[model samples]
Target: MSAAPSRPVCILGLGLIGGSLLRRLSDTGGPAFGYNRSAGTVEAAVADGYDASTDLSAVLERARNDDAIVVLATPFTALEPMITSVRDLAPDCLLTDVVSVKEQVSDLVRRLHPRARYVGGHPMTGTTESGWPATDPALFEGAMWMVATHDDTVADDWLDVAGIALAAGSYVVPAADDAHDRAAAAISHNPHLTAAVTATVGAGESDLALRLAAGSFRDGTRVAGTAPDLQRAMLEANSVALLNTLSETIDRLITARDALREHGDVAVIVDDGHRARRKYERIAGSPPEPITGVRIGDARWQEELRRQAHLARVWMG
Candidate 1:
């Protein structure tokens, strides 16, 4: 693959993701610039020795003809318009976004800027925090970086993006836009919605009972603390996948309930739940092997699953 060009990089959002990327790029000698809608955020980022501004044109102008611009902070509602604006302002620049959902945004990018070089990205890393103030240089360390690409993304440029993830202390993974969104729905987006529901139900109970809640409650509901708008964006962006996962989860819960009702003891259901959770835990921290098939139910899947289980055992020991 060709080396990443020497063109300066511009980030179009200066919130947590944008701010964090700016800091990482600065530390790593990576070309980095930023733009944000909020003057306060832009000023803060600039004051922190990052080249950030509130002017969209100014940021775009800073990017070279072939440079990459990473859209970091815009919400889903604003994304289409922003891409439209960016196309007008930086038509020749290669573009990428840190949006949580890929398929929708990738489709939008293709529709809006057919000539523009673009790839969809989800860093799969963030904290239960918001704003430029919450940005940390190390936030992406050891994170999973999903690059959603298609036939359009130039092979050389795709590798450059992958290299950025590696240099930023992340593992690179490739997935088609739909696959990326569905997997994220199962693991990231759906979990947040469930957490919100769990927390909401728990909070609706008597104040005395809530006061008596423990670590398990806090742990289970931690993702609920994420900004409501962010969570809404994720769910809305991948509604189909999220809904499917939700249905499956509901079915599983009903099955467990039926099992408990049928037998005096729920040992079988409990054992199944425990085993499933353990299997999940094993895969959680490890990189999955490239999905070699449409249905990951074959020997390769079993091998990767067993490898993860062994790693989990070693870590536990």
Candidate 2:
């Protein structure tokens, strides 16, 4: 693993992602603490020997004093209030987020806390679970964590965020905000919607059908078990990209349905899907690419990093 971030971290939200991040940082001896809106969650985290509290002002104050990297791990709908507090209390702190959609979050940061050095991030890993109780310290292990790079992004701020991701055992993929959202919509958001549809159709069938459901059904519908509110928040925040991707998916499905009805064959969709799945498997099973160093303050560093990411390369701290 790369070196832990030099600055302390203050996570503003103690749900699954935030809690797991706190746990992983603590396990790695990184200086980190968290804040949660729920008193119950705060109490549980405190009881478990974590530095957590329900006082938003105090957490942001500490972040300001220590110049900590403040991670906003709240849901999409909850970001405004949290960013408001960060703006009020920690205006100059290095801010980053683990929110699923990057463009929206980056826009919010620019609008609400423009003085803060903000680097948008999204870790491409999770389970069909929610809240502090479902937190797993190793949830991000070997996962792809995206760090957003734009023309105005501060190189050192990006490095700090990437360092945290690397310390958590994740490979850093540097991408622009819009590109991240569009790609995530195709892979993550669209899959969740399809999973929900598949699960609903399966459940609508007879009891015997559900009883006979095995590995394929279970695997396909696994993400459908995520909290509805959470899924809705994420999906709705990336609506434009999700809509485009879903339209493409619907068209493909319609083509398959028509082929099956008219010619009794679905080779077009089936063969394409098989090839895509195999490509994914091949990439997933392949060894990691060698780390390439990029001069952080170079004029074209952002472009270099994005180029490396497009080629499936990672940057280590």
Candidate 3:
């Protein structure tokens, strides 16, 4: 009897994130298979020298259990269905995702495929633009990659998974699902929404206001131009964390407003804001220190999760 053929590693969703991953995999000398919701995306991917299709089952049929890695690069709203389809079609293959919200997706994976090997990931970098045309091969280069896996529940080797992320030129950060989600909400999603609000506020101003808009306005509102649907999914999925960050933002604004109203020193307000912003930039710009080699207790892990959860709830509320 002949043995069954192994399926090829298939990347689902050929948008910016998916296309970037496909480009990375192709550079590594492998024929990366791609699946997208749009036929145009699939055709473009095929023309780019990678295998491409919109058929889920057909893509899975070409994947092998060991060599096959399913990367769901879709939006947060499409995650559950995409994951469910992958699980049903590629039961033996390892599953991973590029979704921004890890906690919600992780929970869904755990519930849907209790025994299936899965890893939740979030790449902490992307441009305001999207689609295949917006995809760059170096998109993930020097970026932060968050890998979330439960100790007892996860079966597939995280090292193998981490290797894939490293190959894409990212520094891997091993964190709990919840922690990754909350941190991303604070750093990425919340910032995008705030930038959008800032941009909208300036829209009503005169041409004089536009001319007066210097580097501050440009820098502060850059992310506001990101795709509305993508931004919506990210902010809505992690609303808890986003809200928490928003609250803090509101409080700061209130403080500044009160201080200014009370005839506070303008220099004091500007200096305080500058220092805080600089500190944030420093922390976010730094690389993730390796936390894999060391292991901690269940209590510690639970505590950390609780802390992340609390932050999300507090901010979102």
Candidate 4:
């Protein structure tokens, strides 16, 4: 049997996050492959001159090597099944994900794929849009990409996954799985939930609120229009962490309401919010420390999978 090819980066979904990574790889360097459940999505990628496949075997064939990395960009709902599907086929490969919920995925990867090097990742970027057509290769540029890992994971395993994130222009941020999830709950998950509720309330009894809604209303509820399934999956996946954050947000809302009803000072709440907003804007402008060593976008994605699968078949035979 021939030796398996190495360094292949296989993306196992062609949604916004996955497609964006594929585009970035094409520009920056490819041995990058994309797979989507929808054959049409895979064909669309092929038309764009990407290495893509609809078949699981074909996708795995591209990742069947020691140095290969498979990035699962599927919804958190599909993450466990996808992890289970590929666990034994590519034992030595470094398998990671671009899901929002880290603790669950990190825990599952640890339990199900002990032989595979797993790093849970969340790229902190997206619009209210969804799917391949809405994808931008530069989406991750200047964005924070959080990676979650446990103590048992080695340094190289973390670096291998971080490489894919940085090569696409992300600012690499590392955290423990539970910590990452907790932070995500406060910063991302709760905000999205609040946006949805805001939108719902603003829809109002007479539909007048929505009709009269201006930029302030539009801006506030922007994320409420995000793909519902995506929102549901992520919000549900991180419910434990999010519940605490939601309670805090509700408390603040009640405090603001009380100040209005009780004729107490509401300006203080406004001042605090303004201060927080300014701090956020300032932090957004500041650059993070650059991460080194993620330059692996130069290989043909599927060839690596093909070679590995052939090697596997021959060895088994």
Top model number, TM-score: 2
Please list the C-alpha lDDT of all candidates, in the order they appear: 0.72, 0.91, 0.72, 0.74
Cα error, candidate 1, residue 106 (Å) = 0.9
Candidate 3 lands at a TM-score of 0.85
Indicate the TM-score of model 4.
0.86
Q: CA shift at 208, candidate 2, in angstroms?
A: 0.7
Worst 10 residues of 4 by lDDT: 308-317
lDDT of 2 by residue, 1-317 (tens): 74567999999999999999998898788999999999999998888889999999999999999999999999999999999999999999999999999989988988987787899899999888889888888999999999998877887888899899998899888899999999999999999999999999998998999999999899999999999999999999999999999999999999999999999998999899999999888878897684477787788889988888888777765
The local lDDT score (0 to 100) that residue 55 gets in candidate 2 is 93
Indicate the residue-level lDDT of 109 in model 1: 86
List model 1 lDDT by residue over 1-317, tens digit each.
11222455677777788788778877777677788899999888878888788888777766745366555457676787678877888887767788888878878888998887786777889989989999998887777777654544565566556666665676556666887788889989888978988898999998987999999799999989989887788789899899999998888778878877887567766788799899888777565444333222333433442244233221100
TM-score of each: 0.85, 0.98, 0.85, 0.86
Q: How high is the lDDT of residue 268 in model 2?
A: 96
Evaluation by TM-score, superior candidate among 1 and 4: 4
| TM-score, predicted candidate 2 vs. hidden true structure | 0.98
Q: What is the C-alpha RMSD of each candidate to the true structure, in Å?
A: 6.2, 1.1, 6.5, 10.1
| Weakest ten-residue segment in model 2 by summed lDDT | 287-296
Clashes found in each candidate (C-alpha, N, C closer than 3 A): 0, 0, 9, 8
